[model samples]
Target: MKLQGTMLVKENELYIGGVSCKELREKYQTPLYVFDEDLVRNNCREYVKHFRVNKENNRVAYAGKAFLPIYMCKLINEEGLCLDVVSGGELYTAYKAQFPMEKILFHGNNKTIEEIKMGVELGVGRFVVDNYYELELLEKICEEKGEKQAVYFRITPGIEAHTHEYIKTGQIDSKFGFTLSNGELYNALEKLNNYKNIELVGIHAHIGSQIFEVEPYLDEVKIMMNLVKEIKESYNIDIKEVDLGGGMGVYYTEEDKPKTIKKFCEAIIEKTEEVCKKIDIKVPILIIEPGRSIVANGGSTIYTVGAMKHIKGIRTYVSVDGGMTDNIRPSLYQAGYECAIANKIGEKRKNQVTISGKCCESGDILITDTNIMDIKSGDILIISSTGAYGYSMASNYNKITKPAVVSVQNGKSKLICKRQSYEDLFKLEVV
Candidate 1:
């Protein structure tokens, strides 16, 4: 397996952030989520440095849904990146971390009344309103508070980005945002004219997640810029911002080829400037809410091998102590991943094995038909590039406890999130 972020190998052993894998396993135990702190900060710096349309007003909001532990929030704040939250809990996490309220952008398709109230009360920077109902609801909430709230209308540009069907959000059939092709967005904008407490500051659209190309984004920019022109002509509302929401792809396995952050940012900046110049509008403040690309490659999940089963000419199943409970992407999206025996790095890749999780479901498989170094019971298995959705989307299915999370930097490791205890599973249960 190829190494990423600050990984190095010495004496036939793998090390991440200068700490040996065996050291991490010994200190944190098995089924661990490891993050490289320097890598994450570097990614943030890359965006802040390269993802510039107008350096004065453009923003890089780190989508908290990728992995929003409180520490992560603090790290993002420390790195000078804004936070993009999709739920109340994420916003609250940022609040607990003392993140600046004006740096928060609340987003969701079906945001509840409580969440809207929370965002308003907390003075969130912007609300990416999804539907007519949400727009009306936000107006009501802001009026009740006697506050003027900034907002962006999340519209579907009808661009079918090449990705898994489940993650495609920009298509016309998606459940997110007003559909741009059908005049729903125009109607929404018209309705916005009647509201007093809401300020329509921008337009937002997310094409999809794990997207691999730049052409679709370029198309999206043209369409959005045209819409911006029309909105100015028809509604007389100058769009101060345009959020081309993030779905920048990252490497998961050898087959994946993702663009560097520099290239991606340069392309976006040039395109936004070109489109604005052509359409005769001031270049709006550009924003990209990159989530996975910042965290995925910098994180890895380390699990301890438990059982192995081999059936003649069928498959070799290598079971680990953790599964769908900790990382559900493989089962949810059929996501591909690569792994290696941390302790057997130099061994010959003579084993063709399917890595299975400890979950009860047969579909709880992690990797299928992958060639890895020979594995043995008690050996440590580390899956690469799982930092994004693995912990953020984790569940307690089958009553399994989540693993501990640790961030590594400069050969030192510190636990950020503790491993869930059995008591944690039932702590909130009603007697």
Candidate 2:
């Protein structure tokens, strides 16, 4: 993916919204996450603009699991985008940010009883019910609270997109939603019909992440449209919303070809309109939970190269202070990333090296084969397309502290989340 927006080099220094990455690193230390606020706002605006072109009843909910912070939550709220929270901690973070509870949509595969009660008490906008157990919990909570909770049944459309099996969630054999192949969805509708406290208003499906092709989405829409028809006919119910969960891919490397947000949304709308016309059903409100596409390219991670070792003809190892602890996508999904020297963006790539992290395991390699120019100690390296899962999946492995996150906008940088310290790491440890 080509680097665009505010995160680019300017005057031989890595600049994010006109702020120098070197200066931010000096202030925040190595292994820091820097985000361009303007880029994120622009992304949301792009989604809003495309969805508003045809006056479609739609809502763009920022998936908080991608990267959640009080500032990020507030920014999404300011842009008029709803929030999609997976756990109680995420819900609490949104609440602390003072995001409107009515605009929050709670989503999770296995929610605790207390979580359901909290959601019910907070009066969230909707809950995407994953399984029958969650439905039962919601029923009990809603009945006890004496309030009818609005919900959407999460269904597995049984359409598996071509993506990493670990990240593919919408397959028939997945552990998430109820599969549509064995008549389980029909049975779910029947069960929902008997519940008076929970109001089943819609259906939800999320195929997978990092999907470049749109055919999988079109196929899912077809199955969902048919299911909508079946539900309306058999149960005599009118679904109010159809949530197509987000899996829109973003450019990670030069090989990735991602569609623009506008094009992707337009295609889905066209398909929905076509299916609705055929089934004689009105188009429901379109809700998309885009997490990665919205922020994956908006942020970058900076690490300082420490030790450089060349084992004759074997391989060159360039180790950084932080490794799989901060960004595990490489080791987790065999993900690919592109990087450049912060101080020398236009330098010639003459050296072939492998980027390694300062960890004890042999699987701590960040980049297998990278072609870059001369490398040395204390050189700053910036990785592209890491704004989504880099910080969110960070761990305390090897007793390494997590990195800090800062926001850059209009040539100014501000610390949004502080780096973890040794004391902070032991705060949760019990004797």
TM-score winner: 1
Query: lDDT tens digits, residues 233-269, model 2?
Result: 9998888888889989998888899999989988988
Candidate 1 lDDT over 138-257, as tens digits, reads 999999999999999999999999999998999999999999889999899888778999999999999999998998999888988888999999989999899999999999987789
**Relative to the unseen true structure, what is the C-alpha lDDT of residue 211 in candidate 2, on a scale of 0 to 100?**
97
Cα deviation of 179, candidate 2, in Å: 1.2
RMSD of 1: 1.0
- Measured against the true structure, the TM-scores of the candidates, in listed sequence, are 0.99, 0.97
Report per-prediction Cα RMSD to one decimal.
1.0, 1.3
Winning candidate number (lDDT): 1
lDDT of 2 at 372: 80
Residue 86 error, candidate 1, Å: 0.7
C-alpha lDDT values of all predictions: 0.92, 0.88
